[model samples]
Target: MNPPYFSENSGCKSPDQSALIARHEVACNLTDISKCAAYLLKHSGRFCLCHRPERLCDIFEALRKYKLEPKRLRPVVQKDYQEPWLMLIEATKGGKPGLKIERQLIIKNQNNTYTDEFRSLYREFATF
Candidate 1:
């Protein structure tokens, strides 16, 4: 569930409705998504999603509100020296209050080349 990362009141509107829905909270927000996940998942089941780093606090609050405790987080960074641009999160239904923050996943090297790990992860996919 790569849910919309933007707040409905925050961002500029897009003329493209599809793109707007995909990126903005036109249909559902994080709390709504988290609630659905909490309802659907069984005990110990994992709910995974990729989202913007800034929404981390909101995500945590939403997950907890619905009893989906955040268990793991993997920060995805463009370079090793930079702060995370994206976050890969895993929450477990009825899980305890423990969070395991994994190592940062660097997307590119200092020279602007894609990192080996990034390339390997998408090796089977077609690039535009």
Candidate 2:
């Protein structure tokens, strides 16, 4: 954690900069984010992402357009029966087309209780 590395800037410095662009879109949009990752990754480099479910189609399309193949996908929801508001994905640059859809992640039980795993992950937090 160096000061210069964290110095506040109006825009991102490089396409290789990960996470920040995807999370904040501060200096770019979704299209730019995918393009940046594609440019920064090698032929088989992997990219992991968590994004709003509404953007699922867009995400897939972008990845394909950039030659980043979707390899895995998982939906995250609060309850087993609830619609997923977020999705987790793993894509590989120049990877094969086969995709593995992982099991859904339910953060809470039907009674709205946090699962043991989530409780452990969010230790010391009163509410989340």
Candidate 3:
């Protein structure tokens, strides 16, 4: 036998129309003006890490198209910091022309603190 229709169940009065009305209700509840604006900004692809004047123009265009004021969007600047690996490389190559290579294994504890154990290897070409 074919599966029973969902509308024929005891609670459903008008299955087709009831489903449509339920969908409209869900959609209405899910719509938030601020979240919609944020989604538009993310999807525009005009505002990203490329710090160019022309890209700023494109971002302004997207803002205009969405009927949003340009002043509402604030630009955030991040300071670039050197990574530990680069620092290690710089220290290794500095004064001594031939030095040993060393590595440290870091372990994290349950309290979110770290402990390091050092290991050393000799390198003929590395500056100490």
| TM-scores of the candidates in the order shown | 0.91, 0.69, 0.20
Q: For model 2, how does the per-residue alpha-carbon lDDT over 1-128 read when each residue is reduced to its tens digit?
A: 00011112434555555655434445555566578889999999998887877667877897898899999998888988889977888999999999999888889987788887667867887676
- Pairs of colliding residues, candidate 1: none
Best by the lDDT measure: 1
1-128: candidate 3 lDDT, tens digit per residue: 01111222224354577564443332322113223454555332222121222234543444345443333222221212211211111111012233233332233334443322211222343333
Cα lDDT tens digits for candidate 1, 20-103: 998899899998999999989999999999999999999999999999999999999999999898999999999989999999
Ranking by lDDT: 1, 2, 3
In model 1, state the lDDT of residue 107: 92
The TM-score of candidate 1 is 0.91
At residue 103, candidate 2 shows an lDDT of 84
What is candidate 3's CA lDDT for residue 65?
Answer: 50
Kindly report which residue stretches of model 1 are placed more than 4 angstroms away from their true locations once superposed: 126-128
Candidate 2's C-alpha runs over 4 A off are 1-27, 119-128
- How many clashing residue pairs appear in each of the predictions shown? 0, 0, 0
The lDDT for every candidate, in the order shown, is 0.92, 0.74, 0.29
Clashing pairs in 2: none
Candidate 3 or 2, higher TM-score: 2
